[model samples]
Target: MLVVIGRIGRAHGIRGELAVDLRTDEPERRFAPGSSVVCAGRSLTVKAARPHSGKLLVTFDQVADRTAAEHLRGQVIEADVDPAELPEDDDAFYDHQLIGLRVARRDGAHVGEVTGVLHLPAHDTLAIDAEGREILVPFVAALVPEVDIERRVLVVADVPGLLDPDAAETVTPPEGR
Candidate 1:
């Protein structure tokens, strides 16, 4: 299985270091020294990585100069991982694990299905297909209380306007107009 770990930004310096926008939470493992990742159909080995101005500065053994790093700009870095490998944190879940899971409310009423997971800068969002509409829900404990993988269901809070904005309660207009 291949997972997107980061995206290559502009070349940082003349030494072939490039700024990377992280897509995965496990940056220490993904961009660690000696780690190998695929980019633009080429396998590259990480020589070093460090946090720089909210982005990661990474040097690849394959990229020897600024021109080589420039060639990789805007390319996505993907890591080949084991299908059975799981995150160390029990609360963490891979995108594949959450996708296709049935979404339900706190009352166990069927709501929709998780179609995708968006890895935003702040957090991950669950893209749900409900009644032909796409609803984005923040993957948080307050909103999504339970995730029963055994049952293949994700229990979301029964908050109005969450599942359906039009269904939310609204006050009626006064009798004047």
Candidate 2:
């Protein structure tokens, strides 16, 4: 399986260094020297990398000079990972691990099945397919308290209107004269 680690930004200098917009939490491990990544259907080896501003300036052995780096701009960098590999953090889960999992309420009521995982600027969200309808739920500890991979179930908090919009209480305005 392949996971996105970063996106190639603009060329940093006259050299082959390119700024990278991080997508992964562990940048150090993913962008370390001698590490390998795939971009634009080509494998690239990390020659050097360093933190610049808020992004990482990385030089790839396959790219030479600013022209080569410019050609890689806007390309996404992906790394191959084992399917059975789990994140080091217990609370963290890969998108593949969550997809296809059965989503249910705390009371064991079935809500939906996870279709996809969206990585937004704020946080990760779960895209659920509920009876042919799409429902997006934030993947947070408060909302998603438990994720049982062995059982293939994701327990969601019973927040009003979260699972069912019609279940939420409606406010009625006072009668006018």
Candidate 3:
């Protein structure tokens, strides 16, 4: 499956190289030379790639000079990744694997489908398409009890005020009544 590895940032120097913000943990190895990648719906052959600080410097065979590289900025770079290479430890689920799974409460109440997974700096949140509304639930052990990938279902313990927007907010008393 096509997994997003990085996004092309700005053109680097006068060369055909482009700055890339790597999304994958193994960017140094994934974006190396001779690796093939897809960007903006077009397949590109990697000529050279090296890590620069927190980002990656990449040169594609299709890109030549700053002008060509500029066009690719903001485009996401995707590559065919082996599912087996992904982490399989407990409590860790790949975002792609979580998609389309049915979400239910521990009491067996159907909530919705797993539509998306948001990776925040603080924590990862599961986006459940509950009926018409999207419910953002934290992927914590206390909240998410089980993730059965083979069954395509995730069992979560219903936390009070988790899905209700009104319940999430608190009213402040008037200062001068």
Candidate 4:
């Protein structure tokens, strides 16, 4: 299956090279030269990919010059990857596997469904859509105790004020009329 590995940022220079914010842990291995990547729902061949500063400088076969590279800014880059090739450390879970899972409390109370995964600057968070309201819960072991991908169930630990929106609000006394 194809997984998002990076995003094409603004054009770096006038040589068709674009700045890429890599989302994967192994950027150098994934964005190697001659690698096939899918961007903007279209397959593109990577003509050259090299590290620059903290991000990657990439050039695609079809993209030429600054104008062409600028058009691809903010576009997500994906590539076909095997799930088994990923790291299997404890407390680590694949975002794709978490999608469509049923989220519930430790007491077996249904909370919501895992609609999507958000890759925040700090860490990954599970996007749960419960009764039309979106709830972002961190995928830490302290918050999420159990995750059964085969059964599509996730057991979340004690997370106060997560379900009630009003719990997050502060009440103020009304001014005397």
Candidate 5:
């Protein structure tokens, strides 16, 4: 099956290179030269790839000029990836894998169910639906200690006032209050 790895941005220069907003962990490997990715339902092979600022500069074989590249703006780049090719790191997991995990505290307090995974510049955050409330739980080792995929459960750490604000100790009261 095809998995979206990146989205093509505006044309970078006159050489048909476009900026890529990455969704994958290894852009260098996924967007390497000669890599064929489906863009806008068409196969666009990577002619070249280079680092540009914080984004990736990618040239497509089908794009020969800036005007041609412009037409592909906002196109999602998808790859026919095998599940075995996914990251093997114990801590690393795909978004699809994390969704639907049952999130609970170490004390067995059911927090919520993971609805989605958001990847920010800093880290991935788990979007949880907890009793009609949307709770954003950071996907970190300190906060989330266990992830049993087979069991479909995520063991959250016991941090004071982390999962519940009322549980946090009042270090200092408000100055006015």
Candidate 6:
């Protein structure tokens, strides 16, 4: 399946190079020269790449000038990557993989189930289905310690203020169980 790798930014120079807002953490592997990428359902080849400031500057073989690069602005870059080739690390995960996983606290209290993953610049957020209420949990190390995908559970570290602080103080279990 194709995964979003980055988004085309503005044209960087008079050349075909365009600024890109990278989505993947491992750009060196995803956007390297000669890599094939898909954008707007069209295949494109990476001719060159360079780091500019905090963003990436890339040139595609089909794009010959600033005018060509201008047309690519805001287009999302995607790649058909094999999931197994992804970095062997616990922290790395695809957005779709986290969906529907049960979300619980370290104390074994059930909080909710992961419904979706929100991608933000600073960090990713987990959308939890909590008692019919949506709870957004920041997918960070300190708050989210473990992701047991095999058993389909996410272990969240105990942090009093991370959830609804005021409600947590007065929370009472529902009468059913």
**Largest lDDT belongs to which candidate?**
1
Note the Cα lDDT for every prediction shown. 0.90, 0.89, 0.82, 0.81, 0.83, 0.84
| Pairs that collide, model 3 | none
- Stretches of candidate 6 off by over 4 Å are 67-75, 83-86, 158-162, 165-177
Q: Which scores greater on TM-score, model 5 or model 6?
A: 6
| Count of clashing residue pairs in every prediction | 0, 0, 0, 0, 0, 0
lDDT of 6 by residue, 1-177 (tens): 677778888998899898988878789888889999998779999999989999999998888999988988888888887865654455787776788999888988998899997765566799999889888889998889999888999988767756565545556899998
What ordering of candidates by lDDT runs from best to worst? 1, 2, 6, 5, 3, 4
Per-residue lDDT of model 2, residues 82-117, tens digit only: 999887777777788999999999989999999998
After superposition on all C-alphas, the RMSD of every candidate to the true structure, in Å, is 4.0, 4.2, 4.0, 3.9, 4.1, 7.4
Stretch of 10 with least lDDT, candidate 2: 117-126
Residue-pair clashes, model 4: 0
Worst 10 residues of 3 by lDDT: 84-93
Off by over 4 Å in 5: 71-75, 119-124, 138-146, 156-177
TM-score leader: 1
Q: Which stretches of candidate 1 lie over 4 Å from their true place?
A: 67-75, 168-177
Alpha carbon lDDT of residue 74, candidate 1? 85
Give candidate 1's whole-model lDDT: 0.90
Q: Which stretches of candidate 4 lie over 4 Å from their true place?
A: 83-93, 106-109, 118-125, 138-152, 155-161, 169-177
Question: Which residue pairs collide, candidate 2?
Answer: none
Candidate 3 versus the native: TM-score? 0.71
